[model samples]
Structures are given as structure tokens and as C-alpha cells.
Target: MTASKLYILDTNVLLHDPKCLYEFKEQDIAIPMTVLEELDDIKDRKKNVSSEARHAIRAIDHILSGASTSAQITKGVPIKQNALNGVDTRLGKLSIFPDHELTMRQGFLPNDHNKDNLIINCALHLQATNPHREIILVTKDINMRLKALGAGLLKVEDYRTDQLVSDIELLPAGHYQMEGNFWEHVTDVKSYQEGKYTFHQIDRSILPNTYPAEYIYDESDGFAARVISVDEETITLQDLNHERIMQQNCWGIEPINIQQAFAMQAVLDPSIDLAILNGAAGSGKTLVALACALEMVIEDKQFNKIIVTRSTPPVAEDIGFLPGTEEEKMTPWLSAIHDNLEAMHEQDERPQSSVKYAIEKANIQFKSLNFIRGRSIQDALVLIDEAQNLTPSQLKTIITRCGKGSKMICLGNLAQIDSNYLTPLTSGLTYIVERFKDYPGAANVHLEGIFRSELAEYAEEHL
Candidate 1:
């Protein structure tokens, strides 16, 4: 009989995702004896991760509590077990389930370092006796995975519990293959625009001219989108309401020169769902996104809200205490977002129901980044400002928060990474762009103008 396959889930995977136990439906995941030890310590610490780690520890144990007999353990499926027997799970030719206690220990006491080594060693030891069994260690920490590899154990990044499919194959996970003469097939953009359209195999890194709009061949049913109207500064679409929709099609939110137009249109393209803006301060990343979102929320009524948040991550340290209502907690985090909103209001006419009218007429809901959990923000326009400060996992949570009839714009300067948890290339926003580039429903726009002042762009370039 073949030995059952074993997947050794690492501590970081559980910390990143509390539901890691359910990800690998194919194998029985053994909590590395070492990982259980480390988790015990982390469980007691007064940190954001303590309760979650503790919960995962408890959850894993609960799943496998029924296993008792050695004969029952090795022959059938693990019965979806999660046990942490301090003693090794194996005994000479016989199996001792979670109840087996360690009489003499050869490893660490589940302290951080000993814990990691123990988990890795457990897999190595398991491989020795169960020569036919496949053992894989899964983790989110690159360093931990590297360590396991150095110790001669196979390892994989834990992505099963994550909403973001890590760099999956470029082909459509699902696609909308529209027939040729597809544009001609549709009598009018409005007539057959009820369902959403997805353009497959979009390459964000390619030059603009290379885009294949004519081949927009897919008719997938997902968050529905449409091409309502197109202009130099905007391409408007309608939601289920049959209302007018507008996204930034102009070169800039309010461009001062012709050069800003191309970049702005790229930024506004609803088809282009991602972008990278790398100019120094005084650039228009915030304004352009806000303007586009505003246009969608007010002018178009495409969504019910204009949600803006920032990562405000400590490149190393924690941000100072955030206090007050959701809006208040966001005060410290959204200075850039506030500045742009204030600028937009500065030019407003205060016309009856004007600023108030757009928000009131459109029924816009606003909230901070730190306060966006446990809510399904469906059919909304979300702008994740200061995206460079977010980790890849953080961005995934935010993007997954998008409900039906929603569009998310992640705008940031790669040169400005403030999250201690991530770097420019590794920041959550860039990771999503790089990872999701092939999906037809998404697009990428890289904006390069510094509209605040040419001096800012000059310093960014020459200095």
C-alpha cells in the first residue's frame, strides 16, 4: 500500500491566512512539531497576530482529534486531521496519533529557531521511513522556504488560502472568447452591453499601439462592464442602471499641457485596471485616480461609493496610533488623499447639490483603509491610494473586497515604498499588476508625468 502524502504547513502560512488548513484538499497537512512549538509562543504574545495564530493552532488540532488507532491512521485518508502530538507522529511500523507523548526529545521546545528546524527535520525524517510518501513544506516567508531548501527539504509558497493566485499561468483562468466580426456582430455597443466583457491575454508591459481591441473576443459573465461612450479623455460605460459612465480619458485629470493627455487616457481606461506612476512628489497619481473615481461615482453613477485608502505601512516601524471614527483614523494615513480632495473642492462652485449634489445624488460611501474589513463592497469604485506601502497579501485582501459591479484602481509611485513589509517590486500593487496582467478584464497603465512641477520630474530624473 502507498504511504499517504503529507504536506508540512509552515507557521508563516498560518499567520498570513488563518484558513490555511483548508487549502490543500489533496493531502493531510501535518503541523511541523517545531511549528506548533513556535505557534504556542506567538499565541501568547500581545500582537496583532497572536489571536489569529492561536486560533489556527486550535483549529488544526480540532480537525484530527478523532484519530487514535495506528492501524486506522495509516490505512485510510487522514479524515482531515490536525493534531500536534509533541512526540513524533511515527512509531516503529505502528502509528501513534496525537496522544503519543514525547518521552525523550531530540529537538527544540517550539521556540522560534528550534521550531523551524524541527518542522524541516520532521519532513526529512518522514521521507526516510515512508520512502514512497511525498512530503512538501509550504510557507509564505521566502527566507523560511530557503532555509528548508538549504536543509534538503522540498518547499512551496502557501497560496491555496489566498485570494490572489500567485503568478499563475498567463492563460485565462476563464475567458470570454468573442467571435470575429465580433464588433460587427453587436449592432450597437448599447444593444448587447448587458453582460460583462473580458479581453483575454492582455499584456500590460507592451506598448499601447500593440493592444488588440478588435479581438476583444470573450463574453464571460462576471462583474459586468460596458463600453458606453469613448472620448479622448474618457471611455464611458453603463452599469445595470442604464446610466452614463465616465472614466478618465483625458490626458490628465485637468491637464496643463498636451503631454499629460496620453498618460491620463491610459489612466482612465476602464479596460486598464492597473497602473504604475513613478514620478516624484507633485505628480498627479492621487488626483487622476480621484477624478476618475469621482467621474464614475457622480457623472456616471457606475458604483455606489468612492472608497479611498492607503497602506501607510511602516517600512519597518508601526504607524502611530490611529484614533476616532473611520474617517478620523484615516486622517493620518490619507494626507495625500485629503490634499487632492481639498484641491477638487477648492475649484468647485458650491452650486446647489454640486459637491453635495454629486455625493448626495450619487450616494457615495467613504471609509478608511484600516476600517474596510468584513464588508462586501459590491458595485463600487475603489481607489487604493499610496499602494506602494502595501504588501502583496494586504493588496490581495483589499482587491478581493471588491464586489460585483466594482472597479479598483491601485495608484502609486514605485520609487516611494513606505511599507516595512515590502519593497518597490514586491509591494502589493506591483505584485497584482505583474500577477494579473494576463486577465482580459484587467488592464495596466504606466503614467510618467510629474504635473505638480517640472522641477519635481527633473529632480526625479536628474537628481
Candidate 2:
């Protein structure tokens, strides 16, 4: 029989996913004392981080409650499948290493008070004490992993159990290109018509594994349509009215490319309750979303108002605190929204105060995500920007808040995820795009062309 490995987890792993404790199958898990201290410090933080920390602490306490004595906890307590809610049946042990023997390592300083270095030293201590067992350190921090490997810890790995994809390149583009003879094959499919739209039904065998609202284009001919329905036997597609959609202006903004046009169609379609827009930094995600929301809420009167929110993960140094109302406090974070709104007003040739009047008369609200829980939003256009900074759990909380007669637009650039716990593959925006691909009334678009400026495009490409 193969011996069980000892997996030492870092604080970030627990913060990233509280349920990570049960992910390792039949492996003895170790929690260093420093990790527990860090969790204690973070448990009283903001909603997202605090909730994760609390859950991790609860899981540890529950596991330890099954043990009778401190000796069992120190030596190791068996982690039963029943204790972990039947997630895994692999019998392993869980222990807390409360102390580490002081040792002199070549790379890391002995007197260094850094938490990362201390965690590395704890893993080193475990390896030395348990020569027979394979010891590994699991962390989401890339630099910490490198430091551990440099200190002669051979086994170091990122916690990837919850990661849906290994690389960002493997993420879905939300569209597909049909074969050269696609139009020729389309003649054989059944055709029908809906209100102001034409529909075609093709055998599922012909286009296997396609999703609703996924764009399918024929390069041979200038033909494109969005998948409207899919089933066991056939897929139904709605012919895209690109000319009409592009020619129509939304709050003084018009689609500049096919990608942008597709995004506009999805956002403007009353049938699609959810739309996800992803692209490079200069791809005009916020601009397109705001334009659609303004047109719908103000001009068309399709929705009651526009509600804007975003994840507040800092890019560099975090400002300690700001003194103001909630909306005033969020000004720094929502500057992109203000910038886009100003640009729209300029394009419309409206006076500067007209922007303020539109905001007041249209009943636009800027909200902090922290207070979004336990509230129901109805008959509104909810725009969540910078969605890549959110975790899958946090995203769920926000999405579920949408009530009847509501539409949501999620916009983000996966390459610019500011949260330390998230990556392109694990971000909430990516999660929603992949999970909702097959769901009806859901659509996604990846805008490729950068419209901000030539300099911005050059910086994105080369810098």
C-alpha cells in the first residue's frame, strides 16, 4: 500500500476556498500555527474575506471536536468522510503543528518575522521530523512556492482542485467559426421565423457541443447567427441582424466591430437576462454596457433604473480609509464608470450638467458590494464591473440577488484580475461564462478589438 502524503496548506489556500480541507484524498493535512494566527487576524475583515476565514476556522474546530484529547490533535486525528459531509471517503488524518524547532536555513533568515518564511520553515520542520512520509507545501502564492523549493523542499504545488482550467488560453471564447461550407449545409436545415428574427433548426449531430447564445459565423459567407436553443436532437439558431444592430445607436455609442456588435445584440436583447463581456483592458466593455443600460432604463423605459457595482480589490497600495458616505467612498473605485459616462455625454454633445441631470432623473445608483447581500433587486439593470476580481462564491451571492424582471451584465478583463486569490481560469467571470453557456436567456461575448486608443492597444500588445 502506498503511504499517505503530508500536505501543509497556506493561509491563502484556505481564504481562496474554505472547502479545500476535504479536497486532498487520503492525505494527512497539516495546518501550521502561523496560518491559524493569520486566519484569526483576517476573520473580522470585510464580508468576502471574513466569511471565508470564519468557515475555515469552523471546519478546523469541527474536525478537532471529534478528537478526544490534545494528544490526538497533536499526533493527528483521523479525518472521517462523515465529518466532511461525505465529500471524500478517503481516511486520512488532520493535525495542527503548534510549534517548530528553530533551525538555520541558508536562504531564509532565522530572525525574519515574515509569515511566509515562517510557514516555509514549518514545512521544513515537518519534512525533517517525518522522513518516511512525503511532505508537500500547498500555496497559491507563486513566490512562496519558489522560496520553499529553494529551501530544499522538493514537493511544492498550487492548490488546483477548484480550478476549472489550467491555463487562460483554454478558456472558452464564447463563439465558434463554422466550416467553409456552412452556408451550403444551412440550406438543408429547417427554417422558421419569430418576431423580427429568423430561426433555423439544425441536427445536433451536425453541430455537437454548441451552447445557447453562442455566436456561430461562416467565414466563407457573411452569415452569422446566435444559438437560441439546443436539445438532444437539434439546435435552433436566430439569424443575427448585425446591420440593424450596428446602425442603431445606444446612448450615442455605436458598435465598431463584429465582436462589439455581437455584444451589443446580447445586451440589447430583452430575452437574454444575463450577459457576460470579457476582453482586453481597452476593449470598451464598460462603455458598451453602460450605453445599453442607459438606453434601456432612460429611453426605452424597459427597466426601472441602473445599478452599478464592482469588486474593490486594490491594484497596488490600498488607501487606509476614506471619510464620506458610501457612494462618496466608492468614487475612487468607480472612476471607470464616471469616465465612461462623461465620454457618452461628450459624444451626445450634451452639456456637462446634463450628465448629472441624467444620473438624477434616470435614478442611477452606485452601490458597494458589501451591502448587497439579503436584498432583492427587480426591474433594474445591474452592471457588475471588474468581475474578474470576485470569487465564485462572491459572484453567486451577487447574481442570486437579482429578482424578477431584472437583467444583469457582467464585465471584466480576465488579464487584469486584482485579487490575489483569483486567476483568469478561477475568476467568477470565467466561472459564469463556462457554467451558463448552455442555459437559456444567457449570452457571452469576448471583445477583441481595442477601441480606447492606439497607444492603449500598443501597450496591451507589447507592454
Candidate 3:
């Protein structure tokens, strides 16, 4: 097959999604030797991305395994489309560009011991060698793309294979607010009662973009309901008592706002398997999630244990260097959870003792995101904090570990993503919110209005 374009992948692109090799259908892919060297160096590191680097290396090795000679390796190997998701199309070729051998030329980017410059030089060499074909340099690094474009490489682009949404605003908020009374928008409605709960079957046109577990609320009428099911013709919504939901206490924590109430309701619900809560910092995502988790595990006896894990930036490299057990090492990163627990029991005469009692009674276990792979967690509430820093693939690795009777609560602040490679639109939190909106078992609630303090609310808005 005649390849349409020659795509040169940067190391970060492969690290972002190792399986991205098969994503560019019918187009040839060229990996620079520098990228391989970087992956080799990163694979042995004590970092979160080390696993991703290993996966990327394995993917490249699998594709090039069938190559018989160096000439065949450089020339390219056909990507086996049959093994990839049953895709029957004529796939493209995968080639390893020997950028190390490229001679520095006039007007070309000076290598300067920089891997990015070498990769750019490879694209330039490829463009010169394959004059008639399109050569595009794909990198997840914004500055790398800019540098590639400045170095006379044409068609520089960011890796968009795992990017689910083009705009962060397009992401689902897990709830919709109507302009006026929600009842006024319904043209046809059939109300029914089952097991003391009221459900209304409304025409699909009432909320065309609605999805399961998304709440519909009208402030004017003081009404709210959760979408239970959606069909082509109609949508079934279960009536929610707004006052009751707001008044419900979870381990001495009450919802301060309607969005928080919706999030707490989702977390406390027995039917929901995955509840995602995202918002600005100090929006009480962790507090509410932890409170509900404690309520279920300690008071309600809905689960056997509470396993809390979050993406720790420093823990990636320094976790082993810290003294004490895994949970003790994770305490600094998970301090917010402890603060929430303390706040929950602060009103008691012996707050510290109460916090200790709750921890022991609920079997709260602090875990690291890196060590959670390949283990099945059953009959527990898995609370993932700072989820925006995780990639979709990494989140999948953790999410798939959930066994029977496990509930996952993901808390994130999209505005506060600290990962250099991740954006709000590409965050695993955003990915799952969009991917699972249609599923009946999951719910996402974007909490608004910071309730931490007056200063926090002002900072969230102005700063």
C-alpha cells in the first residue's frame, strides 16, 4: 500500500499512549533512534512513567520483531492490522529512523545534545529523502512542536490519539440546569411509582443531550431528578427530594450546595459503581467523597474497607526514600483525606480519638497509585484523588483492578492538573466522565463554588 503520510513520533507521544502505534491507520510511522534511547533511559527509572516507557518499548519491539535485517527494519515493517481490534483496512508501515547517523547540515537545528533537536533533524532528513511524501513530527510537548516548526520541519502536530475532547468546556458536568421550571419543558410525561420511589417517563426532546446518572435541576421550581435510563423516544428520571438530599448527613458532613449534594448522593448511592467529582481546588471534592466513603464503610456497612489512592508527583521518585510503611509514606500526599476525617470528628469531645476510631473501624488503607496495578480490590471503596494528573490508560489500569462489590470514587480538580503532559481535555477524569456518561453504573458531578473558605472562593475566582 502506498502510504499517505510519514509520521515521526516523539518520545512523549509514545509515553502518552503506548498503543498509539496502531492508531494512525494507512499512514507510515517513523520512530527516531533518539526517542528509543530516551525510552530506554526512562524505563529503568523509579517514576510513574517508567511503566509507560516499558510498554512503549514493548509495543515497538512487537512491531519490529518480524523484521529480518537492518535494511528491513529501516525500510519499514507492515503493521499487522488483523491483530488490532479486528481492523481489516490496509495498515501502514512502521520504521525506525537512524537519527544518530544524521550529519549536521547548514541551516538545520543544532543537536546541542538535545534529543528533541535530533528528532527534528531526523524529520528534516526524512523530508529530504522522501521528497514527495508528507513528513509530520508528532509530539506531546508544546515547546518541542514549536522548536520542530522553527527548525524548518513542516507539519508539526500534537499527539491526539487519547485526547477525547477538543475543548474542556465541552466535557460533561454530570448535571444540567434548566432556565425555568423543569416541568415546563416537558411536553409529554408519564409518572409511575415503584418501591416508594417516583419515576417520570419524559419525551427525549425534553433533554436531548441528557445521559444516565446526570441530574436535571430547576432552581425556580426547586426540583431535581436523576436520569435513570434513556431510550430513543423517552427518558426515565427518578424524582429526587432536593431538600432531603441536601439535609442528608454523611459522617457529620452535610452538603453545602446543590452540586455537592448531587455528588454526595452519587457517592452514597448503592447502585452507582463509579462516581467522578471534579472542580476547582477547595471545592470539597475529597471531603465529600471521603465523608460518603466513611458513611458507607463505617456506619452503613455497605463495604468491607476503604482504599484511598491518589496520583502523587513527588512519590513517583521519592516514595521509597521516605521512612516508615507505605501508608505512612503516603500520609503526606494524602494529608487532605486526613484533614477531612479530622474535620468530620472535630465536633466530638475527643476529635483525635474519634478520627482514630473511624480509621480502624472503617479499615481505611492508604495506597500508592504505582503499586495498585495487577491487584484485585474487592468489597471496598476505592477513592482516587487528583485524578486529573493521570492519563486515560493509567486510569484504565487502576479502574480495571476493581473486583466484585467495589465502588470507585474519582476526585479531581481539572484546573489544578500538575502533570506536564496532561491537559484538562486529555485528563483521565475527563475521559471517563465522557466515556461513562451513557453507562447506567457511573455518575460524574462537577462541583462548583469553593466551600473551603471565603478566601479560597475568592482565590478560585480571581486568582
Q: Is candidate 1 or candidate 2 better by TM-score?
A: 2
**Candidate 2 wrong stretches, greater than 4 Å:** 1-3, 46-48, 80-91, 100-111, 179-182, 347-350
Higher-TM-score candidate among 1 and 3?
3
Give the TM-score comparing model 3 with the true structure, all chains together: 0.96
What clash count goes with each model? 23, 0, 0
Q: Evaluate all candidate structures by whole-model CA lDDT and list the values in order.
A: 0.53, 0.84, 0.89
Model 1 steric clash total: 23
* Candidate 1 local distance difference test against the native: 0.53
lDDT of 1 by residue, 1-463 (tens): 3336667667777765666565555556566455666678889864445655777777655554556654554433343323333533331111222311323234322424455555666666655556777777776566767776776665445444444434423322111234433333333332333356332222222212222111122233112232333334333333321111222242125643222333344445666544333334666666776666677666666677877666555445666676677666666666675566656676566533355555565554556554665678887777777776665656777888877777777777767765323444445666676666545455444444566777777888886
Task: Give lDDT tens digits, candidate 3, residues 1-463.
Answer: 5697999999888888889998998899999999999999999986678899999999888889999899999999988876566755557999998899988988579879988888889998988888889999998889988887887887999888777788999998999999878777877789999997899999998889998999989968478899999999999999987778879898788989899999999998888999999999888899999889988998889999999998877634554567889899889989888898898888899999999999999999999877899999999999998899898988999999999999999999888888877888888888898899789999999999877899988988997
The best candidate by lDDT is 3
